[model samples]
Target: MQLNQALEIFMHGEIGIPSAENRSSRQQLAGLDILHSDDVWNQQRQIADEAIVQSHAPAEVLALLADYQPSVDHRITLVDRPTSEHAAYHAAGYRHSASEVLLARSLNNLPAPDPRYAVAQATTIADMEWLNTHDPAKRAWLTVTRLLEPRLRHSFIRLDAEVVARVRVCQVDPAHSYVTNLYTAPNYRRRGIAQALMIAVLQQAAALGECWSVLIASEAGLPLYQKLGYQPLATLTVFEPAEASE
Candidate 1:
């Protein structure tokens, strides 16, 4: 597969959600994020399949490309690789910036003022009961992805993963580390959904004992995150070998 396509699948492959409602929640949260390429990011809002899961989050974020400096972060846990000769899970890591957490947390803390929206307890699986009544067809195109872990091949996301929207944690701490996929979908533009998701994600991380979750925020997202409480650790540079692509 091409690199972009591979990244798309990899992003989808991460996360451990097991319900369709949760799948749609991820996509709805990706409001106006700029990473979806022309083919993916066009009016339709799909991301390139191999665009590099630059940022990592719970399998719900939508904007998939690495548009910002620290735009993408993925969490890896050390475990067995059933398909490879490598040892069981070997790494457990999460990525995303402090700012992303701060901004999103802030939003969730406040009550929503907008009327064209609805909010509910976020989870791995979206509530299907609500969908049957409010959005029955919405589930048809959506999926219930397993947590977006990189190596898991037989999860709900693999069966019908389409977008990456949010990365939420059940437990979080300021010192603990985690990955975030700071994505925003087109249909849900400029509504502070990203910020809301981040704040909630960070709070969970902090509660889980994460002293500082890591992430690469976009230029736009940087100040917001900084305001929320994140400082840059260092710049990560990329150098692809000339023959590496071949």
Candidate 2:
């Protein structure tokens, strides 16, 4: 539950994805862990092109932006609670874009998957494409994820052969599993599809001897995950470029 250890699991799961353009990479510079991805950086879709700072020194913030700016599109993810970094970040031309709760649950006590809904494992580009049909731009990035093979698992529930919900789990090691991309189709919400998919993945992780499962959750998802036994571990505050002044 140490913040750095949690962030390490997050960075390993979200970053380091190989890209066709060779734009995906990671490094430690200016006391920061820098991550870059070819996923076409956007504030809403924070797939990569980021620098993560574990410390709270303003000087480290200044040094990070000055020495390791990956792109104008990049953002800084501070693995700390809301603090004075707001001023330092603003002075550097970034604004607080969002805050997410980092949550974790022990795999030792996972809930059993609700057998009423059948869940399927997706292991190919075709399966990803099916799950991502609503967002075609992500296909290329998903292709890279498929290459990570053996470490990543995608599971989903289908209704009349149509994918209704899905989740991705990254087994970072025998003791750690990182969860991401948990989604349920709009009409399928509140019907237990998301919970079923999550339980299935968690059960799989537990079977693999992963001691923990972790994820960064949006405000909307915090309650549901908390219901499933995940406890908040930290707050990740993201700072991105302020809108250009007219």
Candidate 3:
């Protein structure tokens, strides 16, 4: 079986589609593709919501997400830029920019602050105002914040003086971590703000007694994560009804 095919099965199974598990079991036997780390919070959210709607208890839903949260949830979006092109990672402009995104690492090793830049963790979830800005790229901040409050078991933030450049960091288990739903305000890329924050997230994890962290780095972000000590674990894709078009 091909990696893509295996990935499809894993994703569908993870979403609670019955047949997906049986098929995925076979794909795993073939060692065709590795299970993904960061499956993103949205997929799990949808599955849990469906279950809750079907009559499961809220506590049960919370248990499952906390226990089996995807090992990785990572994304990169334009938060700000000199030009739309300058703000985005892809050649396509800031089409992917959004309010906030999730980032994961198995470790947290925030570098020492240099004179030019600094990195610190957000004091609290309520204090993320700098991240939820009026910039077009950060327009989704409120939405993202609402999405995370109930869903995430844990989280972290990276800040620069008054700016919040990275708004996510988390782990599903003591040893497994995932990243996703990541975004950067337009004015803050290629400046090492994100890199520093990501390091802080990982270092914090280590200090708290974690040994490994994980995340799904976007295509443009693969190299940066590599520099930060992340390696490819798997590539996953999800298929679902098109809510907007439907």
Candidate 4:
């Protein structure tokens, strides 16, 4: 899939349908598509100029973002394929805050699941709550549980009666699946829980005839993904206003 199209699908799955109160507004400025969601969650607002047209003045993008509520400290993702737009953001006082490497692999021969972990689908609110309780940051994604499009699936692995690891997979299309929110409790890390969980998820995706799996891996997770046979396709940079960096 095209990078921009994959990005749009990834963001939609990540942000879901913004609540009525945090609904986003969009505008085209200098060939840049900007989305402003007054959501306290930074991921809800973003700026993307995937086409590299560079027609939009960076000042205009900054000015528009400044209007967002709690804008100074709130973060936003700046999707620029051509590095040329980087200077505009720097001039606008947005700092390079974080980045993720995009990775993809053809689901040809997935590894066998480790018997040490048992993976199962999360089927109810209680199941999701269990996941968030173990990793509070996941609470922000409660909205994804309510989304119907793209066929969301949540899977978890339990040890004795406690959920120890979790992962979310979105079937973006019959031929593609996106994985996100893969988390294993601190106590459970390095015990093969994550690898096992991923093996199970990808197996399911393959069963559904999905041939490709895509994900944005953090620096720490890069090695594991590489070991799983995913190769870097691109890099996505996220920027935050200067104040937010401070």
Candidate 5:
């Protein structure tokens, strides 16, 4: 598959449901509501041009996007494939504001799970809420509805029945899945909980016939993901108007 196509699937696959009704309402006002159509995903409000560009968009579409203006300071995020079109977006004055490495691996062979921790799908909203509360910065924008979506799975690891680490997987399509929000509580770091949680989630995905797993890894998490056999496919870049980045 094309790099952009794979990136789109991974991007949409990371959207999780908000943890509370109030948080959902707040996200809507901030124009963070995700709108999906065909192979493209965008925001409900056009305040920002947050879109997944098609791999073969015509020149007219590209031109229109280059000229489109929002009422407020806006950012345009794109998955930077090593193609001429990606270069064109950069030539159009979209500065590289930030980046995340897209990584993927086949689910054919996963690491052995750690026996010291037990992992399971979150059984209730309270379970999800507790996980969210422990890592507010990472899950600040997630919604309860998205978390409960049938295609999405939220899993957590517990030590003596106290939840300590969590990971989320979104089955974007039949064969592709995206993983995110793999966070371990501060007190629980260095305990192999993250690896255990990832193994549990991947095993569940493989059982369901989802052979490929993907995720965008933060810099600090790069080493762990690399050790797990996830190789970098492309660098996803976010471009913002110059002032917005200032």
Candidate 6:
């Protein structure tokens, strides 16, 4: 898929439909797509809000975000834009929080799943809560994703009776799948668990007739994704209240 097409799919997946409980919302103000989700877990690490810069002037977008303040602490994410464009936001008191690369790959020729490890899908709220016993915030995030994202699935592999690695996949539409939060336990790093789990995810997406999978990858995870045929699309820069950073 073209970079533009992949980005469109990625943005749509990120700004998903709100849950039935009304815990989140998406809006278009000042020619920017903005999102806000209540941090139900009350954890600082939980995501609260973001702004996607399309063709909007940075000044206009900043003013809109400034006016519509959310009740809880929030951060804004500006995706696929140049560092120069981000300077205005930085000057406005939003400090850099993180950066990640957008990646996409065709699911046409996914590798076979590893035989030794059995991959399991978290299909219910109960399943997610149990698997994420170690982190309530992560568990809450997964539950929210299950409610907000379309055709959501969380796949994982266990070691020593605990989840050692996992990935979340969303079938955003008929032909596209979005992957996020691919994580491995610190102790399990360099064990090939993440690669095997992702192969399983791609195979699952292909089985459901999805054609493309997209994700945001950190520098540490870039090599693994490249080996799996994913091509980088753009850099996503995240920003938060300067006080939050301080």
**Top of the candidates by lDDT:** 6
List the candidates' TM-scores in order.
0.35, 0.84, 0.46, 0.74, 0.68, 0.85
Q: lDDT per model, in order?
A: 0.32, 0.74, 0.40, 0.67, 0.63, 0.75
For all candidates, the clash counts are 85, 0, 30, 1, 8, 0
Give the Cα-based TM-score of candidate 3 against the true structure: 0.46
User: Tens digit of lDDT per residue, candidate 3, span 202-223?
Assistant: 6666776666655555567776
Tens-place lDDT per residue, model 6, 1-119, is 78778777776666554455335666777567777664334223344677766566678877887787744466666666667877888898888888878899998877777887889
lDDT of 5 by residue, 1-246 (tens): 456566656656644333332121111212222222221112122122354433434354345444543424444444454445556556665566666778888898788777877787865777666665554234532345655677778888767556677777888788888897678878788778888888889888899999788898877788888888888877766555555555
TM-score, structure 5 vs. true = 0.68
Compute the lDDT for candidate 1: 0.32
Compose the digit string of candidate 2's lDDT tens values, residues 1-246.
776788788888776345543356678775578877654432223444788877747666677667664676778887774586688778877888888899888877678779889988877667666665643223323453453577878777889667777777878777998998787878778988888888888888888888888999988899889989998988888887786331
User: lDDT by residue for model 1 over 4-110, one digit each (tens)?
Assistant: 33222223323223243232112312332222221211113232221122333323222222232221222221111122211211111222221211112222233
For model 4, residues 85-119, the per-residue Cα lDDT tens digits are 77888776777777778788789988887887778
Report the number of the highest-TM-score candidate.
6
Better lDDT candidate (2, 6): 6
Where is model 1 more than 4 Å wrong at Cα? 1-145, 148-165, 168-175, 241-246
RMSD from true fold, candidate 3: 14.1
Clashes of 1: 85
